[model samples]
Target: MMELAHGNEVYTWPGEAFPLGASVKQNGVNFSLYSKDATRVTLHLFASADAASPQHSFELNPSIHKRGHYWFIFVGNIGHGQVYGFQVDGPWLPEKGLRFDKDKVLIDPYSQAICFGRNYSRERAIGPGRNMDASMKSIVVDQSDFDWQDVMAPRHSLNDTVIYEMHVGGFTKHPSSGVDKGKRGTFAGIIDKIPYLKEMGVTAVELMPVQQFDVNDAPQGRQNYWGYSPINFFAVHAGYSVENDPLAAINEFKTLVRELHRADIEVILDVVFNHTAEGDENGPTFCFKGLQNGAYYITDKETGNYANYSGCGNTCNANHSVLRRMIIDALHFWVTEMHVDGFRFDLASVLARDSNGHPMKEPPLLWTIDTDPILCSTKIIAEAWDAAGLYQVGSFIGDRWNEWNGKYRDDIRAFWRGDSGTVSRFASRVLGSPDI
Candidate 1:
């Protein structure tokens, strides 16, 4: 049993493993995580976001709390705004591709919200001891709390779409953007610019990685402003929210989508499922590396080193059964809960690779995304290449998937630059590039 801030005692129950991540129930919140090789798992509950240590910790017994590869527990009396994380103990054999650090307080892979405390440091998560004081924690969120106000997606067709690829912060961060000082460079700032987007005839706005990412993933003094270095797939980037609260990112992003939908414009996210912020082996153990490294990433069989298919230090094992499910689930959540109109996959060719980083004839993850019932109406665009030279531009898998035309872009640029013998190619590009 546990005591709450309200002075009520609540008991712990053996939670179900079907629905993953933290789920808020009527009685309490149920937490579930997948760690196939973990020998021991402990749940740490924080009193607040910046709490140096856990107010309470429960070591999950494999006999009762574990089902298959999932470990779950339900703590009554605790509901929304509960800050928590996991510490999984297993074999730490990096040569064989198991990098488990029980000392590190790992965030949930399916976290709906992440709370980066005042003491949170990315450096502390590397080559670590106990990083509870410097770690980012996950929050138990009640996803149903928000009122979307019956806003429906515009669902614009590709033929009629004029996409404006934009960075959320850069869109309104400038002093002359006219957005309020407090709301600048945030989801609220985007909401304030709906009129301008409508005036420009932009049918869809492809937002560049709004998913929660590590700002400290960049070099010594520089921060990662592009947001391609994702930390959590399900959570919206809290840094994009005007409010400091973790849940504010979720609701504020929803409000941005709702308001954009009202203005007859669609919201498309530039999703990076190819790689994560937890870079190569020497990088930080944020979430995936701490949970089950081999399962989440594509590692070299002989050396046990990370495979850099995405040229971003590591490549996600997208075709792995566990990761395949996660990618689909994230897409479903965005479509159903967040009301997103589409996804523009970054370095999408990486998703077409097999376990050993070989391009598959038919990758399961791409097929799953192509046929996902919830995403049947959602627009799906692929960059059609990886940084490691795996190009699938003209032959990208799946019937519904759209590929970004690099040939057309280059040809058009050459023609306008007065390059000789570029007329035929330019004419072909004008007629939708049939030659490609």
Candidate 2:
């Protein structure tokens, strides 16, 4: 984005929509996206909601822009399903990685349809003093279009993947999952547990945090039973919606990711950008600390404050720069707006630290998400290590990240909890994670 943040304050009227989205131009709707590691960009217009909150807000740094790699702007008339997001700037200096932060309002990680939460509720996108959360705020959705009928996307392959990690409301919501009533744990209750995850063969379904998060976060004193606290990484979790609608929770989670990618199967999510649900500074003012608390976290450059590094207190100054375009617009909206295939990241060596946290063997945000060509083939996976101890584990330079080999989840939970050398370390982690 910027060396410190300012792509005309993020699209008051962005352009270059040959084939992108949100395009109703008689008055307004040109918005386009692609950061190429931002240095400047801006567009955080809001003015829709009322009884629930979210009215006439402002921000626009477009001066007829369009810098390389992608950062266009064109705020002429402004029309059609309006609600906006963008706030880029440059360099906050975490070593030399560049984090930018023109006062926080980011979220277009290639947004497919957002316009979501917290108006009548009081959290109002937090950050002023910690409201519940929706990470700086970025709604504007009116493009759900829904038509997936034939569906698609199981496309499995990290060695024919198997992943399972539950909790879309506790995978079916206990009570023997009789379902019915409240569609027990939604997305059509995982589309009725997708034939029980295709009869347990698994294939792939990772989801620990369907983006638009922030449930019960009181410093994890114990809320979000296990969502890993993320927020609007390009929307999705309107309380896991079975049908409460958020465009039916983005068309039943894109028809449950097009019926598990049309039987090929592959969803991996778990994100968390190492701290959000805005928990720090006494925890809760939301929206990256009131639109720019020292530019999205990791303080103490000398006591400016916050830098817990995933202790869950603060730590997401993700090298800052409009919080790294809100972490590359929430990973390009989970791979072009929730088509998803991979991303685990959680602490990921506190995303390669440096916001004064330290360790950075060369982490320019994990090497710009490992030579990102729109995240190469996606799948980065990390949870590498953080409660601040900094453990890369089996190494982590990243060119396309991978590492939940975490000593193979502690030797298969210590060999199915029995522990003793455990059947040759669980057959060397199923022949070393090819997941044999």
Candidate 3:
């Protein structure tokens, strides 16, 4: 086993590379990251969330620590709540689509929880230079620590489901929400409003993107109010948690899900697997772009420019082998661990595109999610369209996947407005859009 000393403490172990994230074990915490083209990988350990510098940094020797494209290490002393990040060294050739900045501290792609330090600066990550102090760090979490209370999801059928779409923060952030002072705009606040939802006869709550997203990913002087621009899929957004503790969001979100299930209300996450917060080539490198830019995102072969199918700057290469696996793993984690009832994929048609950005007849990622045993019983809803106008409402792949009928919404609105030739279309829409 490899050994590293930090002050008087010595940490040692050769970590496993199977589980892609930081996993807590009896020995210590095992960290594994994937970088197909990276030459060197350095792991940085921080003393605290806002620490100006790393307490210790280890440069993994590829001969020993690397197994294929994965770099892994097990620290003997550290377990839960450990803050860490990575710095990968490789070719910085944007023309060839390889953006690897050794100076920037990149979070784990499979981070269960993230720590945004006081010095965290999205601007600093945009340009060059070291972003260790200014970058967000990933925290090690013991997933087994929480007691789910054996609460199960009340999976309501689509025919009987009355879904209420709401944003977690905006639902109770205002004073008029009547939520407790400290608990307002948090997962705990959602629990307090459960009784109101039950009264409304709402069977399910389709929450806007609750995954950890980049709030700074908006225009200049503006913030990303909506939680659509996600950073990490596995971690819950920390802003919606009551405490600043790194692990608070995880446990609190679990509690919210458990409580909602107890009230016989299902939780459906509006997931954004189409794109990431890391925008185009000029955007910041948080995780995916820094690790393997070419693999994570679909880019132009000649110019190396990102495919803007997501209309949010860059489109995720969901059909790629690595990304397909990561997406499936994320879904599995939410269903098995978080106990969520369903997922509403935002711009899901983007997942239908091939590696070259053309629509595929049968995308591998969608099929995997459809056939996965863990997600077989879980509800799956697709937006059935992308920003680039690849509409597949009636033709969306997967027999089990239900699509959001955009035609029904449009025709119903037109009929209500008393538009021309609306009577015939309106009749079909009210009858469940049989004409569609």
Q: Number of the top candidate by lDDT?
A: 1
Which tens-of-lDDT digit does each residue in 197-252 have in candidate 2? 88889888887877666556643355666767765356677678865544457767
Q: List runs of model 1 lying over 4 Å from the truth.
A: 1-7, 419-421
lDDT of 3: 0.90
lDDT of 3 by residue, 232-347 (tens): 79999998899945588888999999999999999999999999999998899899988998888999988888999999999999999999999999999999889999999999
Among residues 3 or more apart in sequence or in different chains, the pairs in candidate 3 whose N, CA or C atoms overlap within 3 Å are none
Model 2 lDDT on a 0 to 1 scale = 0.63
Candidate 3's C-alpha runs over 4 A off are 4-8, 417-421
Comparing 1 and 3 on lDDT, the stronger one: 1
| TM-score, cand. 1 vs. native | 0.97
Model 2 worst lDDT run, 10 consecutive residues:
1-10
Q: Would you estimate the TM-scores of all the predictions?
A: 0.97, 0.32, 0.97
Residue-level error in angstroms, candidate 3, position 162: 1.1
Local lDDT at 158 for model 3 = 85
Cα deviation of 268, candidate 2, in Å: 2.6
State the displacement of the C-alpha of residue 28, model 3, in Å, after optimal TM-score superposition: 0.9
lDDT, residue 24, model 3: 86
